[model samples]
Target: MGIEFTALHWIYVVFIVLIIGFMVKRRDTTLICIVGIFMLAIGATGDFTSSISGVFNSFIYAITELLSTILIISIIVAMSRVMMTSGINEVMVAPFTKIIKTPALAYWTIGLLMMLISWFFWPSPAVALLGAVLLPVAIRAGLPALGVAMAMNLFGHGIALSSDFVIQGAPKLTADAAGIPVGDVVSASIPLVITMGVVTTIVAYIFLRRDMKRGTFLLNTVSEENEDSTQAMEENLLSIGQKRFFAVLIPIAFILDVMAMAVFKLQGGDATALIGGTSVFILLLLSIVAHKSEGLEKTTSYLIQGFQFGFKVFGPVIPIAAFFYLGDVGFIQIIGDHLPATSHGIVNDLGVGLAAVVPLTKEIAVVTLTVVGAITGLDGSGFSGISLAGSVGSLFGNAIGGGTATLTALGQITAIWIGGGTLIPWALIPAAAICNVSPFELARRNLIPVVIGLVVTTIVAMFLI
Candidate 1:
């Protein structure tokens, strides 16, 4: 039952470590990944020309696999831009300012509201919408910009995205890789996700409050710059009626979309498509309403801007993701069809090998899966690692008796929470940019709370499983 590590496998392991090392130093790993891909290709083909071709093909394959996610994000950003320009985004949060009267209320209110919005429209768009709207309110209500950033990051990216109960994209990714039903993963993840979310956000809020009391919570230079830009953007000329109409219209449209999703039982890609398509339509509608005579040009302009933002965010991620994809189920497609017939995926093989080598009791299985999930998340794309987590979960489950669903859910939660946005500076950019704080600062603030949350969630998962 012993598994031998092939040159490809060994190379994969080495590159993963190098990538983690680079990430730890807060360095860019895109170039390192491309080089790793070349070396991996060479190991597989032993032909310089073929290796070069394989590298290109691997990038192409990664893009193909990730196109849906990229497209949805782009479309949502486009929709948000349209809302912002129309002055609707401002109106969207006007109602909330009434309830968020103090810093404590502002923190929890913004965090909970962000969590809800992120569940439906996704965190990318939610950040854009809320940053333009709620962030200013939070700041005006005596919350520091960094505190605002932490709340938004933890709730939107950390909690909503990690659970992904509404879109079910994360669970689907894990389930598909494990060859299990998505419902099983989703059902099992709910408790763990809630535990992580509640604990992390509460702990982070307390830290924020402590900082405020100590007078260490003054706004940084970045916040002043962001505030000035925000004020400039807010100086828009719009009829009151137009703003009111859109503020109401946008929420109604999203509410209907959610209802439709429930009625249709749409999950995963279908659900994303529903939301993305609705966003496009809303963008078009708002553009036309805002610029009746020049709507055509305006719509195109908004779309062009959205695509630019989307591609800009995704550019560095593609290369890193391509390198990791090769170690998972996508290897045969990325490399060549002629990979050894006996070859299991690099990660899958490693998981099985570990299960064989280690004495895995229930506690050990939980700890191992949690560690593996966290390690896989180092890529800063919470998603790319889930397949590995799922595969490893299955292997471990088979080695033991059962609880594959619980283990898979635990791994999924840990991977998404760590890499989805909380701990990774690169991944925290969306929330950081919106809150106008340094991504590194936000990551640092989130580190303790998230780590504690993950540990508690994993421990709870042990009993649940």
Candidate 2:
């Protein structure tokens, strides 16, 4: 007989519901979810192992699976820190100040720039560079700070990072889970990303334009304005030569990095590595330029500061990601051996069961899978939910006579775009925090345009795939 819905399945159901409830409550659900998963794993394994050992084992397994991706993220983030300390980040964005003359232009400029930089360096570092440099200009251009934050959140983290066209981290994970080539995933994602980008950007522009017309689009808070003015006064007292040299050199280096990446056809992650490594080198060069003989000591201080900033920006995301790693078979195989055999891979098993029941057309199955991906994304970290989506896509693809790769890609696109930051405040916090806006309010504002764009993107994916 086929497997029944045992105690393990019920436990999984409870945990899933709890997770959903916690997300809605906007509480710190990481520990709760982890505990739930732990209990479920124990029940599945039918082991009376110590809770401590189980937790440690599960954590170790999850961390091992995620170590590479996490380390890569950290390295890039660390490199970004080096750039900030050297003032290269500020120098890189200074030129945009001259071109962004109005709120509408500022929005697009910031959005496009964030997307471009994020494509190379990932969104975490891109936020720092944009927030520190372009934000003041954007604010001065009368773009509402909230709007600027939203733009960065949507374009940088959501669209660019989600697509991960350059680095391929996101695509690699999705493809692995779906059991397809990274190249295929990348190829499939391009049209979907473009469609989503255009639709979302247009919708965002409408909202921003309406606000601009109403004269409510200025995002510069009083405190930040005072801080900028104070810094300006301080800067005016210093000699301009140092600033001028840095201003020119930083941009040149970054431009060269970009050129090299494009000309060499470096993969996304490799391109990010190149950018990050160059940024570090530039940071070192600038520290000497800024501090003269004291450059060595100052550089160390700067590096420390940069790491602190990166960690502050990315730390919370780590644990959240750790919990979600449980859903992946790559990690599950290692940690879930202790789980009752019946409870093993509850997520994938659930997907298989669901696929068995649903007599879906290709179009219907694609839409349903995409919707499920989007729903799973409500947890706010796009990568966390993708494994389940990919697994379900594969199962349903087989059941409904569709391509697993296509369905997985569709699900991946939906999840990343929705939960990656485009529609959720918590997921967009890094961008929002750097832009100095409230994450909740940013999410509220993003609801309409992002949702509309998602709907359009989903329709397009269904027809295309």
Candidate 3:
């Protein structure tokens, strides 16, 4: 059951370490990522021409996989542009101004709200739908832009995405691989999810509060250079009544989409498509209504702005994403089938290898599952190598004679929390771009809280097991 390590795997691990190091130092990792992709390709193909092509192919593959997410972000930004330009955003957030009167209130409210919405639409779409409406309110209420990003990232991606109770997608994956009923995994995860969510959000809020008190966070979030575009109040094209109408209409439209998702069992890409399409329509409708004579050109102008912002946010992310793609199924497609016949992707192999080497003591079981889960999660999907967690959990379960569900659930939580979006830079672009913060900065902000939560949760799992 021991995994045979190849040059491809080693090269990937080395690059990952380098990338993490660079990110920690706040250095750019684009060149390192590109070099790593080339090294992985060379390791895989051993042919000069194909290896060179593989690097380019890896980028293409990464972009294609991310295209849907990018489109949704672009469309949402385009929609927000019209709302802002027409003065609709001010009206949209006006009601919340009274409720979230303080930074603490803003952080917790947005966190809880995002956690709730992410359950249905997933974090990417949830971010698109909510960030536009809530972010301005949060920032205006005294919380910085980075705090808003942390709240959304931790609550939406860390809490709701890890648990996935509504969709039950995460549980289903781990359950199948663990040879247990999905219900078992869900039931077992409830307490741990609650623990991690409450603990992490609280810790993150505390850190944010301290930073604000120490004047670490910039109170005026808008940069001086871009103040004219982002901060200045634009002349309202629509009348006050018109702004009020669209403000109400927009939320209602998104609400209906949520209902449609529940009615039709829409999730993931299908759900995202519905939201993206709705955003496009709203963007078009509002542009025509606001600009009247200049509507057509204005609509395209807003779209151009959205695309510009989206690509600028994503530009630094592509290289790192391209490099990690090799650790997953992207390896075969980008570089051809150079993996060992028994290999189940490099990331999963590493998890299996870890599980194979670790002795199956109950105490060690929880620890191994966490480590293995984290290892698998390095690829950033949180879903790609989770089956290995379940499979490994089952293997260790036989030794302990109980706690299979707990172990499996622990693996799922850790994997999703780390890889889902909370920690990974590229994986978290949705929230980062939406809140207009650096994904690496967001990841850094979440690291302490998430790691603490994970450690505490792991210890709690020891008791549960």
lDDT of 2 by residue, 1-465 (tens): 154555655675576566556655545566875686577667756565754465666556555644545545555565565555555555567778899999888989999989987876678778876776777777788887788888898898778977887666677666655545667777777787888788888888898788778877545552465346324322322145665676576557767876886788776457656766766676667566656788798677767765565455434444444444454453455354543455435545555566677666777877877777777677777766665556566666656655666677777877877778777767877766666677888888888877787788778877765
TM-score winner among the candidates?
Answer: 1
Model 2 has an lDDT value of 0.67
Q: Is candidate 2 or candidate 3 better by lDDT?
A: 3
Report backbone clashes per prediction.
0, 12, 0
User: What CA root-mean-square deviation does each model show from the true structure?
Assistant: 3.7, 4.7, 7.2
For model 3, residues 1-465, the per-residue Cα lDDT tens digits are 746888877787677667656544546667888898888888777788887888888779867865765676677778876877787866765676678878989998888878876764456656765676677777888999899889889998889988877556567667755667777898899999999998999998899899899999876663434333344445668899998999899878888988997899775557668888988999999999999999999999999988886676456556655666666666788888899998877766765665566655788989988987786567676765565577667657755667989998999999889988999898889888777788999999999999999999999999998
lDDT per residue as tens, model 1, 1-465: 545678887887788677767755656677888899999989988899988988899889867865766777677778777777767777778888899889999999988888988886678778877875677777778998888888888999889988887666677667755657788888888888889888999888888889899998774424566656555443344577888887888788878988997898776678778888888888888778777888889889988988887677567667766786776666777777535566566766666666677777778888978987897677687875675577667767766667788888888888878888888898999888877778998899999999899889889988986
Question: How close to the true structure is residue 389 of candidate 1, measured as C-alpha lDDT?
Answer: 73
Of the pair 1 and 3, which is ahead by TM-score?
Answer: 1
- Whole-model Cα lDDT per candidate? 0.78, 0.67, 0.77
lDDT of 1 at 101: 81
Every model's TM-score:
0.84, 0.76, 0.65
Minimum summed lDDT over a 10-residue window in model 1 is located at 229-238
